[model samples]
Target: MFKKTSIAFAVFLTIQVHSAQANAQDQTADIQAQAQAETEAETKTENNSIEKIAVYGVRQRLEKAGMLSDSIMKTEVISAELMQHKNAVNLTEAINNTPGVRVSNECSMCGVKRIMLNGLRGEQTTILVDGLPVHAMIAGYYAVDAIPTTGLDRIEIARGAGASLIAPEAIGGTINIITKTAIENSATVDASIGENGNRKVGILGTGITDDGRTRATLIAQYDNRDQVDEDNNWVNEAPNQDNRTFSLRVSHDLTDNDNVIVRYANIQSEVFGGPMLGNTFADGTATSVAKVLSSFDDIESDMLFEGGDVRNNFIGKAWETTEWVNTQRDELSLSWLRALNDDWNMTLSASYSDHTQDSFYEGFSYYAEDTMWYVDARFNYFLNESHLLTFGVDKRSEEMRSHSSGETNPAYVSDAFDYDVLGLYLQDTWQTTDALEINMALRYDHVQADFIDTSKPGKEIDQYILAPRIDMSYSHNEYWISRLSAGKGYRAPLSFFETDHGVLDAYLGFEIDVDKLERSRSVTYALSFDGEQLSMTSSVAWTQVDNLAMLTKTKKTDETDGGVPLLTQLDETATVTTADIALGYAITDNLTLNVTAERFIYDTAFKSSYAIAPVEKRLTFYADWDINGWDLFTNLVWIGARDLSDYGYDGYNQIDSNGIVVASSKKSTHAPSYWTLDFKLSKAITDNIDLYIGVNNLFNYTQANEGESPLFYDLDGGYDVAYIWGPLRGREAYTGIQATF
Candidate 1:
């Protein structure tokens, strides 16, 4: 499972120097200062509408930047100074330090490096590069890492559902990676070397032509590391891996009022980790056992002598074997923007992507392919000096074909899928007075699917989703404000769930009987103090997803309670309540302290008809403290887990009535809490060069489950299962030198 996605990403770079490469970028610095001044000057005239800060394009572009996922929060930006010190390979990692935001790696010790945005899973969130959807066909748990963060302006994160402007079912959130404009001719190259022989390199170049109106950006990155799982427990806490990624973006301002942009990117990555090799027996001789671990269901393992075990205790490997899992993604998209006037703007965007995977589990290999394309249009009208309106229409289609056949498993199948979606929505913002402002939005989404498989019933699913949001802010003074925001957003299942043929048999979330998808409604309240040198925001968000498709907690035979447990897609009502609060203080203008906490609760009974505590909580502390012009930041993250296993026998709702082998559904309720610390220091050695060092997982902590594969496997005989996720590398530290020339 070791390949690299970070290689070819470096080749796509356009080395043809453009006039925009001149990096004495006092212009960007001046523009930022002017934007800040303008915001301050209009802060009172706009009736305390400071949320409009940073919309002006200075060093970057923000055309597709919308608070698509949040109503209470407008567009936000984190300075590049904040990004320079961290190991930012993707947008999720770039925004990890923002207040009330989280980019969590779900299976940190796996073959694929996938990440979850916010609290929702990967499939639940939409990954948009320069406002275009990027389809990376990665192992479900490790797909997020394939995205390249080498050439970025900044990432915009919408914490709530932003279905009003885009497609529905962004139930968790949306991450939009904006690209830098060709403001100058500049190139930045950074290389890092760290623990476990880990090494990474990032190269970014941006150039502008056409008298500074046209811009081109190219970025490439590579990451390769050795495998070192020290526990010798037969499990690689984290697999050794290789990664390569590359992308190029070109933009031309057709006129002062119209522009067109095009971008292309690709990723190739691999990983390897398997069972440990050492075993203990009664005779003190080394022994191997059969069925030691299974990553896929269609393969047979001959590690041990079958029917020869004398004790319940099992000891096998200290890293005896490894597999190679490979994944690749290619994405292309084009966008056009036209400014009708100072108050009117229109944008059209289209994208095409192909995601391919050549993943192997010893004798079994899975080769899956997916291709998708979509187009969207947005229109914006400034109602007045202090009011704005936005509306849009979007259409998208996707197709996936999978040929999964193992050497020994006769149950393999080839499947195909096709899906289409269309949506429309509108939003309005108004300043009621100098002391108050309000925003309201609504959107509708419809989708259809076609599946080509004979083993499962082919069905067409259609859905109409509605999202509404309203946020009100009242200013008590120049330094104080109180706000209340309430919004409703929904998440539609991915095409794989409705159109992947038998893919649903692999997970419980897909096992649904209804013809419609699910929806989420939320409300949040916030209070903040914005002073001359400090900004503190405290917010609480609560949401509920009615008819959320959840896995059946109690196992049964033949789908019980009208629920599908075997990766069967279903629609069940679920309430996910989260309490979040954060504070960000800019101490002495050069330093900032940020801390956040969240309490999350999930409705497990909506699908199971039985109640369980699926509670989780998180706390993060981030600080950017500077010393003598050197910028340093430290982030500490912790996740409190709960026992989420329901060992119910069978795939049905009815329990075994026979007294002899009746399998009772006993649940395990306690999983240990996990914590990680990351740190980075950036020193501007010169105006054109920077020095940085960072450590990820300062404590070198790994996610260790106690004989449970729910996080990485489909235990119900569906998808493949993998145990001992290799040694989750501990204490990754890296140092690098970056220069802009």
Candidate 2:
């Protein structure tokens, strides 16, 4: 998307800046504390919920809101108590502190990020908002960006195939984001400004009107800064970028047992590559962001020259991505609490979602729109006070299109492509005893995608996929808990197959479809111990992929196919394995800390892509303190992940004499350890106004690239580290004031 697309575009073109900030502080320990609060009362006759029994999703886990993770089913919840008090920008970074989870940021360029649940890659994790599928088929691997942290009321994480309640393909795990619910009347407004010209504002209000219940929230955030590519490199250190996000939501209790909810959100922005800031002659090559910044011992002189030079080269190569993301979601829930009955109840739910995406890179643009529907019903009957039989069924349908210039797929090549899918599933959750419980589920899907190449139109893909899953949990009374689970999942082929991207961070180098890929096995084990003000949790999980699919240029059917190479997903590469672990702590009523580490070992034979991410590890620190009308917190992270690959192909940069493309195995370079730290402070000045102040990248450390001068040196500044390693955003200061009625 370009700057001229909206008034925001004009602001982007005129302003050139960057940001160097780490994510929010870890607060899961706080979550463990809130979960201890038992639900007691209900709303006044007006509308309120009294804290009653706080059993989480246990009794009905994997039953309501598509919650796959619960006792007997294996899941975790981080509610509003944990979300509201902290400064969280995205889910990826926030979930990093969750046990057995990792925010594997694949590329540091142009929104290259994804959340890895239980060691599974972005493609393996399914994201749901209020029981509805938000990421379907082609669009996967978005954690924080798609959701505004402020709007979320709670987060539910389930490990393994999500059984049948969700789609059957949640082989690794599932994370469901629950939005705020209905209420009599409530209003909240948040506004803050931080270091590096950073500013953020949010407003949320909900109430029961004459007709129905409604809740709404709006968030506006901004960050701008300067950076020096330390190396005498051509790439930028921290390219300049700006962003804005807006969201709205409403829910209503229509009838005795019927309810409905709706949500809408949009995020738009412009990003200038710091690593892409140098001169290039068509071929991709360069120094790094770290190198450019390191070259100047004399900060003043270096800035004058480095600033102008980078701008000239950068603007010339400024590849603009003008994009707009719009989503419309609807959910309907019906529950039969009881009718002249004792311990029997049934709940049925249906949801639908529509997504519209349009992106323009350079002068070429790509657009795609997709719609999906989901239906689920569950019946629960109590055998006794200590046991219950819960069972259900689920189904979904999806239709999508990729369009440009006007036609479909490679046909208009510049046009759009379309496809459709239908799926069905079933599952059950059983409470064996007060101490033991079990959950089981299964699902099947049939989908067909088409490429409308008006020219040489030909059928490329058609497939039906099946998936199944099961899980169990044991609670040693109320203080100790354990869970075990397993499941199967798969990804069918699509028409746009092995295609191309207009962005640099586009991994895989081609389109996604090669051959129909399916994963047949899953394993997950987790445990938790809770104390009055302290809590602990640990988990281990693994997955195996069968009949994996990948594209290989070296083994192409016809090297002379003119680079439009023949591609297919095969059964040869199969069985990829992965595992993960985590821990958390609370020191005092005012302070909390958490730590989580994860590992991914790709089974070489399967070749499903993630191998390039290396043995990744993350260590985070958090501390929140309130004093004299002020709220302060500090956050830091130390990350280490290494790739074992070594590049050997020679003269690979040169095209054939006839301009034909030649290829070699994708190579990943070494990425050393990097660390970042940040801190924030907020003050309440009056009944109607408040203030926010903070510093990001407190160390001013960044991956070094480019050069402020010839004498300086920056080893960490290169595009190489972007995918494998990351540098600090650099030190920045910001301040802002907010008002309320």
Candidate 3:
């Protein structure tokens, strides 16, 4: 089916190109004649008064689209105006409408969310700030929620494997947050409130010194929300959160050709969710919220066993379990840029960051800390305009410490490690003609890792890797553009914290394969069109990953109960292919619409104990209208059904206490499809103030409607709450006011 669709799309593209060319040729004569008349009229009116003509059209939209389409590496830019119009409160909400990108909320307890690209797992994507890789270790999973959208210039997103030529960790692409610079003294404030006891406040300001040699920018934000329960089953569908973030940046000019920038950021958050008040079970284990919501429940079931009339035995029954996460992060960075004559420039940047997280799930406690230092230096040479060269070197050192304390047999299990990476890279860009450009990059990295375990006498691990990439772009005409890119990327060996967040205490006795590395090779092709009133983009990416690290259940020993699960890392091979098409048109002077369709096909030879993203297709539509002082924007999104059977949890067999094996519940295999509609309206109260209101999930669509809600129980009365496949929060309405000075 996918092959046939691809062939049809190719044919359609050919026809479109031909039609565009023919139309362009036919319109050439008309345009020339119109230009001649306009010139003659303007010459005659030169001695008279001049008049301003306002043409409400797609000029601004097309200009932004053109800038993105002309790049050698295909990139999608999300402007601040769009963010405000869509009422995006954070980075997660900002990219919800983007094709090939998804904000996946995996765990229900703490509401852990990550960005998934092209249907791949969240871990495959790399998050960056100002072109620097900052999400590492524990920060890679939970810290994404703390990033506020207070002072962003724009967000650049690359969707595909190996989308970044310099950052090898970008196997699933990159999300780079670009910061806005201060142009003059200004201040802004925004406040909002929503359903479910949600509230937010933010303030941002910028200033420049009288001498114009120094500038500063600062932003602060606070957000709080209660748990969300659409089904009203005494279980929270969305966790409660209290989050705060602050950032400050300053830039100073050292000389006419040199400048320095310093920045600092702090973030803190506390999130919790699970069974609330009045949560009680038939069994004598869990009675009230205070008793059942603070500890992990043991596996106990009343379901019939393999032997007729026999029931599974339970050791320690605790039905109440609440999930909680407390995290704090601090970062400081400094950078210096200098111009060496007219043809050369140099840059140096360094940063230090510290992150700590404390979490609890059903009485299981896990704590982790990560400290990292990074430095980068680069030089750029223009080399006479047509040719450009860039050389750079970077180094990073990170230390991770993780430990778990709970009622498990191990009592205490901890892992601590340190690693360092040093890399050198060179890139060259050549313009063969006025309409064609080629870019090539090569990089080499050396890594040294040391595991600290006094009981095992740890040893040092070292490895070397090489990466290469090539990108090309051609401008066929003013209305057509084409680009192609290919690259090789790799991720370093995983630490204890990266694998499972140190959840399972059984890992204390498990073995690990430290030599394995996750790597990928990918290729992509893109085509774009920009007409007088219409624009379109289409692209396809194919990626193959080798030695993919996957967590699996290992064999049990006599000392370990058959019920206790141990995790081990395994190497596997995987492939992902994705294709997407986007189209935009100006229906009228005050109305514009955009539509996108995307499809993904993933293949992995390894069948593990975890569930991967099962979504295969997505569709998105967006429309904006503006007239007078009122503005309206709307978005519609649809997701395809997924197969739960892919994770192998259909009536599985497990051992019982009597040394007998029994079959578990026969669960459903298919997750149904769902759709949502969001709307926003705003009106200008004054030149410096505006009021806006919006509704999300206007249809109140949810997975619960299909009996696939996150709240679920096994045949034996064992509760599990993390099987979410769709929107848990049904509907939300919010209103806010913004003021600028």
- Cα-based TM-score, every candidate: 0.75, 0.70, 0.83
Candidate 2 per-residue lDDT over residues 578-610, each given as its tens digit: 444444455665555555455555565543444
Per-model C-alpha lDDT, please? 0.53, 0.46, 0.65
Q: Is candidate 2 or candidate 3 better by lDDT?
A: 3
lDDT of 2 at 144: 41
lDDT for each residue of candidate 3 in 178-231, tens digit (9 for 90 to 100): 776665678899899998777888888988665556777898989877787665
- When 2 and 3 are scored with TM-score, the better candidate is 3
- Which is the winner by lDDT between candidate 1 and candidate 2? 1
In angstroms, the error of model 1 at 277 is 11
What TM-score does candidate 1 reach? 0.75
Give the least accurate 10-residue stretch of model 1, judged by summed lDDT: 14-23
